[model samples]
Target chain A: MNQADSSTIVVKRTIAATVDELFDAWLDPDSLAQWMHPGTTALSTASVDARVGGAFEVLMHYPDKPLRHHGVYRQIERNRKLSFTWISDATQHSETLVTVEFNVASAGTEIVLTHERLPGQVACAEHTQGWTLAFELLADLAAKPLVLVTFDWVPEMPRGFVRDIRVRWALEEAGLPYRVQSVPFSDRNADHFSHQPFGQVPWLTDGDLSIFETGAILLHLGERSEALLPAGPRGRAETLEWLFAALNSVEMASLPWSLLQFSGNNDGTPGWNMMDSFLKKSRLAHLEPLLAKREWLAGPFSIADIVMADVLRLVDRFDGLADYPACRAYVARATARPAFLKAHADQMAHFAAAD
Target chain B: MNQADSSTIVVKRTIAATVDELFDAWLDPDSLAQWMHPGTTALSTASVDARVGGAFEVLMHYPDKPLRHHGVYRQIERNRKLSFTWISDATQHSETLVTVEFNVASAGTEIVLTHERLPGQVACAEHTQGWTLAFELLADLAAKPLVLVTFDWVPEMPRGFVRDIRVRWALEEAGLPYRVQSVPFSDRNADHFSHQPFGQVPWLTDGDLSIFETGAILLHLGERSEALLPAGPRGRAETLEWLFAALNSVEMASLPWSLLQFSGNNDGTPGWNMMDSFLKKSRLAHLEPLLAKREWLAGPFSIADIVMADVLRLVDRFDGLADYPACRAYVARATARPAFLKAHADQMAHFAAAD
Candidate 1:
């Protein structure tokens, strides 16, 4: 069975988590069961013997049948690498070699998976396809604990106004389950600043990756599902483009204007109001034409639409979107989604519970 | 020769350009010469007979050897699709069918290329590798004419303060050649408003894609080269995070404060100056510890560094970064790159020539 020209497939992915978390997940029965199976395949069982020379087994319950996969651990380098010999029902004696290496990347861990020594052409091709799907699931599982941080309570004026709602809306749209953690509104301590540099609420943590910006957190979630982002490159690029546009261009103008109104400074300064009005109006005017033709910002209701809608909703709240009918409708359409309704309801309930 | 199970390799990329422009580039000899070959492989000659049933030839001059690729046009549908039969020295008699289809993507055109009918396994493997490289090149060529738009002149106070410098610096860092187009500073014409709704300088156009916002433009350039943005996913994600951090988080705070200083409104308002100072100082203080440990924002000299450095440089100019020594040093290190020096010099020259 020594096919000298046997093919080897290598797949690499960078997950926004530490090496320890990712490496441990490979050996943890629960984590392995969650991600080892391909799309829509249920894991019947995952038995892990994590040490060298130990055995492990996983059973995938497909719609038609169940497939048993067994392996013997050959090497285990904690937080660094692992290698094993794979044995399956179809290729019980062939014994494929699979090696996974974890390298510390800039912000996370890069996992390099090499599957070697498949018996024949068809098996090689099928294994390659399986690994691709499995790796994507692994990437999703490795970046875990998508936590949304907010305040325990806020005044009625700023109740729904907290930034965590944007994140909740995104998670609901993507159908990803998450937990909400709260800090006391009265005291902003060192722990708050450690997670969020600005000591602001709505910072997110997926595994070890803690990001402060709501825009960044939305993008991190967008990577997992096409419901929040499109699968194609064109849609993904445009989504990122408009995502930045909402944050930097639209929100940058709307935020200060909204702040001035809240602080009762809209009519206080000599030229601040005029500058604020001109800036907001000019940005809205630029957006009118695009919204007139397209239903969503990046065609198929992507995170771009989510972000742009969220930014404009604030404007809509302040009655600032009256001049732009298309943008107003866009926001209306986005908010009318069932996911948005649930997210808004959940957010309201969470804050109301505190009261 | 009729290998029924012959392999077909398909590659698709969405270029941020119109279909008409991308189609013309495929036929234009000059454009074909620029992107027909893979990286560092020079195009020796490109002779075109673009009409259907006509033949065309291209010579690729690699350092060690020369290769000639000949093809005959089978069908052409101006901006939608094209098909040809490819004949090379290796497969002169066993010609391959190559089809390219263009579809309107969300923000641009998506090109799908299929290379079909390889005679053998080795040929199939070789062709797949070739097509992948060629497709990457085609994507770069398809998105052409990266233009940076700025004002013809600005007052001495905002001379170097122009936002276009950020785009220019990014382009230089990516080693991308770009053209600068200027609008009249005195009149902010309708054309200016159309391109930049805020009548701001420093929007960019790549082929048919015209995008405003310096942050957006830098990201567009970052897509072209890993020199500006890391090719790895982790670094890229972190780069985007920090890029937004510079814009939505840091610049959002700094720009208004700097503008107030430029307009000599620093001492005018009793509470405005206090709010401005508190906002700027708070943001800066948050940034200090991060800069202290890392040489670059995201652990590499990426577009994130370029952005954070540029934003902090402005703060330093206004004497606002006095408390943040690490940020100051980081900016100095980034500006010290030859690419930054060239971009700064070119931007100054472009404006000075207008004067």
Candidate 2:
């Protein structure tokens, strides 16, 4: 009847590594500077305090931005556990808790991390989904000899519409030989549901494992090929930040724009008007400045570009993106890659076959 | 246009280490084991494919539950970028992406990570928020000699209500010195807005960094202490899973339960009985089994406990939780903490003064 019985979310991960090795990396600040961030810039400052009730901080600076993130430690439990509070001075939002646990397993070490107690339901659900994706990426990056796998499905393929361009491009950019698993929209049914939770095409499988979400699959592959992300802690952190901006900041603005076009109504309904207004304002206020300088969101052709380009591409379906020349040029550069072309062709063929 | 234009969420972090020293820890499977999981069990079955178009996988097993997580690599860009997909085969509905980028920053390597395209808006926001907290935790764990800082505030302290016990307990657990920042409910001025985008209380700061969300702040502290998270990757992952479940799954289910009791007032109206019955059934069905399991939601004392305790506490306030012994016990343990007591006392005193 203790307080432990009522929790709902549980996170558990097992990695193949010895406990001592894992503990050393966690305890030593030097080791953290390595894999902490997968893509983007690099770490500018990192300091540690490992004793109980001690405090610590890490500052990650982006070469392309004026912002710096500072994280402070709350608790330290040697090799067994680590806990801390997270905050972004730039945003001034309430901090969140992150707890990491380590133990020994037959194969190696098992890591358990719990980030809990977001302010609201919306925030909680969002973090749950995002963390799930990030963990997958971590596992793939940690894997050895890197494995790359890809699948191809077209937008108009099979009996319905599918968005397979993302996976195709990911495979192409990573230089992985992939196969096509196209399904007509008409045939996407219970069988598909069993394989893909969302009942969508462009699902990917590596060995016996299967993934449905496009972004998740792409990140997984990026870990294997190291082609979609940057190398270094600060770089990786920056890459992750862009990923969030793509999904949250940029994507949030794009939704209404897409919805307005999809609905195909110009009426000034309360919701529609609100959406349109939001889209217009957000684009001018946030996105315009974001694209004013950088050729890429982070630096190189990381998955951040892939995500932004995909979302931005959808904007072209509705409002021609000519007004945002920077965004347009960025998209053009991203799609101009040979690998992107191959992936696009493969996806188009799948859809054409459906026709 | 400057670097800030290209990047919005960049930070300047300086560390002392060569690129090879940092990169090796992430690339070498053995080195990864050291810091991969800070709190729980060590990693098991770690493998990597460092080349482009390679494959990678990591498997983690949970000792107390029949759960295992598999992370698959999707792309890798050698000492540069890594992406992967995470999946929980047992859940059948779990899919996520994680991208990590590595780069050189000053004398050390910077890592940027992006987890893109979560399931939905709610999921995306929550995950992004969670990452901020987790990053703080990671930073703290990396820093050995830590200096902890924290803050406490009540939800409706301005109106003489104190419900932010969790924040206080977290601070106490980490044994950090802190101060209180009070806000009035009626104060909707720019000052409040500057501190909290959502105008909520329980905001915190660490040196120049500030955080507004309670959950995020807790995680930031937890990462520094490593006391709240289990050891090992598997354990760490599982802990994170529970953190999500507590925040989204169980907490979401409890919402209806609370609304039914306090906001129900059927009056035999249309959809009244249906709504009430639905809420009752949903709440019971979701919680009964969760209570039947082990003492804690994930294991031992963790952030999941803090989150679930808060959620259940809310439920109890509306309708006494006498029926659910496990849940009730869970609440009792959380409230019994000395930090919780101090927070409650301080909140009460603040409210009393306001009155």
Per-model TM-score on C-alpha atoms: 0.58, 0.38
Query: What is the lDDT for A318 in model 2?
Result: 67
After superposition, the stretches of candidate 2 with alpha carbons farther than 4 Å from their true spots are A1-164, A176-215, A320-322, B1-355
Clash number for every model?
0, 248
TM-score of predicted structure 2: 0.38
Identify the runs in model 1 with alpha carbons over 4 angstroms from their true place: A1-145, A289-293, A322-326, B1-145, B182-199, B207-209, B268-271
Candidate 2 interface RMS: 9.0
How far out, in Å, is residue B3 in model 2? 56
**lDDT accuracy of residue B211 in candidate 2:** 51
Give the number of the best model, judged by DockQ: 1
- lDDT at position B205, candidate 2: 56
Return the DockQ of model 2.
0.01
Candidate 1 lDDT over A78-196, as tens digits, reads 98889999888655457989999999999798888887877777777778788788878777765547767788678888766678888888898887855566687889999887777
